[model samples]
Target: MRVWAHDRWPFPLPPRHTYPQSKYGLLRERLIAEGVCGPGDFIEAEPVRWSELIKVHDVALMGRIRRGQLSVREQRGLGLPWSPQLVERARRSASGTVQAAYAAFQVGVAMNLGGGTHHAGRDFARGYCLFNDVALATSRLREARLAQRVLVVDCDVHQGDGTAQLLRPDPHAFTLSVHGARNYPFKRIPSDLDVDLPRATSDTEYCAALESALATALTRDGYDIAFYLAGADPWEGDRLGTLGLTKAGLRRRDALVLDALRGAGLPVCVVLAGGYAPNIADTVDINAATAIEVAVRRTSIDRGGPDAKLALEPRDAA
Candidate 1:
């Protein structure tokens, strides 16, 4: 599977900042080291053009971001200090999802090593997110006539408030978010479908809720592609997450979502949404596991396996 990464372009962060900026690079290295993906499978993402961003974001907001003119309140809401490199990084990160969405059409699955910036709304940035990557990808795909119907499966511990706000009103898009009920973005925007698991929810309960949610979300069969925000923060070890899912359980969560999407015959674009494990390595481990799952599925499809045949069969694209 092809993976998009932008960690080579580093952005500055405050000393001892809570955000795990290192995990992106670590994940890329580990995936190559473990042979889950070859170095050639990794592609360096370019910064998304401002014209493409304006299709989904407000013009004023884009101007402020580009000119480094964000007010103190806006900066506070963004959670990251304004810098040229920061703006460049956000553009590159958003570009990765757009690139991955296009790549998924060729391969059964593709991945963006860093993304899932679902908290940035049309005119606002919040919760460490500066741009709604999935929304941008959706818009780009529609403009190109590659996909009219899109599904966003956001499993981050935090609600995808920005994504819900931007895409929920579109008749052709389905936004389904399974997140901690009491987590960040206390004033949540509703997705098309939301399954809010309680704090300290166990893996079994989490999977059960997710499986049911997937069943409901996949009932309609015309989605051209699905974007999966396979967040690692739900792990018990994560500082920012309140769930009780173990590493094994998170793997199960990935399988449940991937299998359902594959069964629905929708190509998958996987992204590393959020992971704040106290140990950075743990976050890397979880993200790597998600990549491994995508790789395994791609291999299955490439070898003319049952999954390949299932994927090739025509689906109702109404």
Candidate 2:
């Protein structure tokens, strides 16, 4: 398996500032220590150009950010205390996803230790997401003609409102969001396919829903590539996630997506979506486990080992 990672410390971070909406660094740190990924596997991508960002974000709104002219209304809507560190952190997080996508396209699977900020909208940003990396990557792939059809599998507990909204008019990319029906972003923008589950949903029901969704996305839609937002927020211990999924349940969710992608002959690029645990360490651990699962599954397939391995194989017709 040619497992790889993207360098995500793209923005300069600050020392003291902290908030629930701004603490995503732990996801990157844990991936390194747990052998889920290493410095050797990581590739530093050039920061996404303004042209690439402008493809989805409004020029006027982006200009204000570039000028560091943050407003009270914008900051509050973004769910952060306005500071250079916070601003830089959010910006780099989005860029990391685009970098990960480029990496994964060349290999088979790659991950961005930080990204999956799916809630930022064009002409606006929100919900700890200054920019929507998932949307940005999808847009780039489409504009560059790298993919004809793209599938975005967002399993974050909260809806990917921004992603759904941004691509609602664009038909080339299909957005599938499986989230807690009662969670934040109470209002939703329609997605190509949305499976909204009730709060406190258990393992069996969640898995069944996820598997059915994955099968439909890969088989029915005929997407050539996919972006999987394996959010840690779905874990039962998460403070923000409304649904209660045990660690095992979360693993099953990841496996279902991975296997489905392989069965459909599509490559998947993973992004660490959302995780807000009362204990930050718990959130980091959750993301690390998913990363390990993807890596191991990738390895087993390359070696053609015994257990079910989620690796892409070209379709016979192709």
Candidate 3:
């Protein structure tokens, strides 16, 4: 399996924020150590081009961000204090998702160590998201004929409102978001397939709903590719998550998601969405476990060899 990552790309999260040592990072390290991927498996990802940003993002807004010129109001809007490094981190995160999609095209699955910035919008940014990678990646894939029908499965605790709004009228893509009924992005947009779960939903029920939704996307909707935003905040210990799933339950959650795609012979690109726990290590560990689960399953099927790499992904960066 091919997994995409870059060292020193995150925004240098605060120690107490619980986003710094996120499990997705650990999962990447764990997957490498566990033989899911050799050292050579990871390839450096290219940053997204300005033209790609123009495809779905606002031109003036893009121009402002490109110059590291966030207005005083804009700074407060995204919450994090602005910096060039933050800009670089956001760009890399966006491109990482694209690279992961390309990697999945080469293999049955690819993991993006950081991405799924779905809260970003065409003309604005919010909730730590500076750009909408899902929209950018999907556009690149469709433009390259890598996928005729793309399905975005966003399972983050917060709804992929930005992605949903951007792709709402796009016929080539299908946006499916399963999130907490009352969470971030209080005003939710309508996704092509929206499933809002109640607070404190059990693991069994959550997995059941996930399976059904994925099944419908792969089998009935007939998507050529799938982009999964596997957020770790669904865990019970998450500082911001309202769901009540345990760590093991979260693993089973990944199983249900990956199993659906693998069973349908669909290639998938997975991203780290969000996870804010009281402990930064736990948050990081949680994200890592989710990634481990996806890689473990992907590597198993991928051992069948190169034919398993037929999943198409976007190749063009510009």
Candidate 4:
């Protein structure tokens, strides 16, 4: 499997910032160390072109971001300080998802080690997301004639407000977000299908809701590709997430989503979304498990196995 990563592109953040910037690099390293991915399988992502950004983002917003002209209020809403490096990193991170989407056509699945910036809208940036990468990917794919119908399965703890805002109007795209009803960006934009789970929802409850939602979302056929935002923040230990899912539960969540997408014969592009465990290692473990699940499924599809089963079964706990 080919994986796109942009963790090498450093961005300035204030000391004690809560964005968990280091988790990207940590997740990449853990994937390699655990033999789920090899060093050669990783691709360094380049900054996406302004032309692509304009497809999903407003030209005025792009200009302000490029010129570092964001006002104090805008920066506060972005939840990160603006710098040349930050802008570059955002472009590179978005590029990872775009590249992964293209790569998924060659392989059954591809991944971006750092993406899922789902909170950035056409004219606004918020929730630590400067650009809506998945929306951008959907637009680019349609422009390239690579895909007409697209599916976005966002499993992040927080709603994919930006993605919904941008893509919900398009009949060719379907967006499904299963997030905590009480999480950040409380004023939610409606997705094509939104499954709002209560805070502290357990593994059984979350998984059941996700399965039912996927069934409903998949009812609309003709999707050429799928983008899965497999966020790790739903873990019980996450500082930002109030859900009561264990690492094992998160793994099960991955299996359910991946199985559904792959079963539909849709190429999958995976992105590591939000995860904010108090111990960064815990976050890394969850993301790595996701990478491993993707790799296992890819291998199974390539080998034409009878069943695309997971090589590493879900453990009871982290």
Candidate 5:
């Protein structure tokens, strides 16, 4: 039930910025307001030590990003203006995922309110991502001897190209990305398992594909932890997402993933990925639904019973 986040996640950006930075705050507030999470459920993201960050990121890239010395081309690829606040936010977000992973080892499940930066590579950032939080966390966890094997379930509309490439040669980490086939970063990197859906794919099709992918991933043994990129961009209303999943469908999607992970007795660290609906409220609603679903299921699993049905209430209250 521990959710890591930081106030600086929503840095002051100029009006009309393409990235929906405000959604992070809105999702956090809505989760509390809707009784899905209590004020105590939140944990501020601590800054990640350089020693840990260097485990996954290139030292030169890290140095430039820290000093705000990224070249114009590098900054352009990052898709975020260089700022001291931005650097700090990226660091915190990376740390937040690591915290969530550690917390999940204690609890059945944990979350990072602003993570899933899968577009960030070891050497560079792209698509508004400065650090591959999940990748860095995976490396840190392995280095700490916390987990022997890891699985990444990326459901974002855009392919987790960076994550796939970063972990391509890593036998200990398994990457499974189910994303829009023709989405951004057209050149897709091969993951351990990739389920590319056609444009305008329906809810049933996406779920079926996901079920197959989950089954395949579960076939492997000895995975100690799972990092789920529960992206909300697959909603039909999303501006960037071409898929056509309804809100209810998206909720079902959340249940499917959470139930599978928790049912298998694996620790899961959930991260909110991309969600850019034309109506920001729609995006917020989808992300909130994910939080509620994970919180509910985590409680049920912790209580030593069947996977909890999606009741959308805090564990103590339930």
Candidate 6:
């Protein structure tokens, strides 16, 4: 499996900001240390083509961002100071997901170490997200005719409001977000399916909800591809996350999603989304478990191993 990472290139962030920009680089290091990937497996993502970006984003907003001309209000909405480097980072980060989509088609699975920017809408940025990478990638794959239908499973603590709105016009795209009921983006937009959990929701409750959501999606015609937004923020230690999922619970969650998708013979592109544990290491470990889960499942598929038996099972949601 190929892992796309753009954290090697440093981007400027506002001083005193609590956004763990360092987690990107740390995730890469931990992946290597844990043998989830070797140095060669990590590919640097190039900046996305403007043509591909404009498929889901607005041209005027893109121009303003590149020119660093966004008003103070707009910049605050992005949660970052506007700089050329920041712009480059956003472009490259989005590109990583686009690349991962193509890679997933070639391989059984692929991953983006710094993507899952689901909060950026077609015309606006929010919650530290400058661009909606997964949305743009879904559009690109559809335009290329690489996939007939796409599924987005966003498990971030905050709702994928921007992605839900951006892809709302496309019937071929389905978005599902299971997030905190009361978190960032208080005004949540609807997804194709949303399983909102109350604060302090445990792993069993979270996994049970996920199983039901996947089953409902499977009731329709199957999708050609699935984008799994493996967010790490649902951990109990996360300062920003209100739920109470443990690290073991997070790993099981990843396995449930990845195994089910792969068992259904759908190529899955994994994206590391939101994660904000009080101790950054905890967040990194959770992200590591996600990547390793994908890698292991992909390897099993490659060896013609037994398919996981959890793909379409029906279960009651907690």
Query: What is the TM-score of each predicted model, taking all chains together?
Result: 0.93, 0.84, 0.88, 0.93, 0.92, 0.92
List ranges where model 4 is wrong by over 4 Å: 299-318
Question: Candidate 5 deviates by what RMSD?
Answer: 5.6
Model 3, clash count?
A: 10
lDDT of 2 by residue, 1-318 (tens): 233333444343345423344344555556667755553545433345566678789988777766677577886677655555555555555666765565556556667767788888897777777778888877766766777678899999999998888876677788899999989788788888999999899989999999888777766657767899988888887878889899888888888887777567777788887888887787777777777767865523432333112222210110
Cα-based lDDT for every prediction: 0.86, 0.71, 0.76, 0.85, 0.82, 0.81
Flag the better candidate by TM-score, 2 or 5.
5
lDDT of 1: 0.86
List, in order, the clash count of every candidate structure: 0, 0, 10, 0, 0, 0
lDDT tens digits, residue span 31-53, model 6: 88887777666767667766666
Q: What ranking emerges by lDDT with the best candidate at the front?
A: 1, 4, 5, 6, 3, 2
Give the residue spans of candidate 5 off by over 4 A. 299-318
Q: What is the lDDT of residue 26 in candidate 5?
A: 82
Error of 4 at 17 (Å): 0.8
Query: In candidate 4, what are the lDDT values of residues 31-123, reduced to their tens digit?
Result: 778977667666766678887788789999989998999988998999999999998888888887887787677678878998899999989
What shift in Å separates residue 62 of candidate 3 from its native position after superposition?
A: 0.7
Model 1: CA > 4 A from native: 299-318
Clashing pairs for model 4 are none
Of the two candidates 2 and 5, the one with more favorable lDDT, higher being better, is 5
Candidate 3's TM-score: 0.88
Residue 45, candidate 1: Cα error in Å is 2.0
Model 5 per-residue lDDT at 109: 83
Model 3 whole-model lDDT (C-alpha atoms): 0.76
Better of 1 and 6 by TM-score: 1
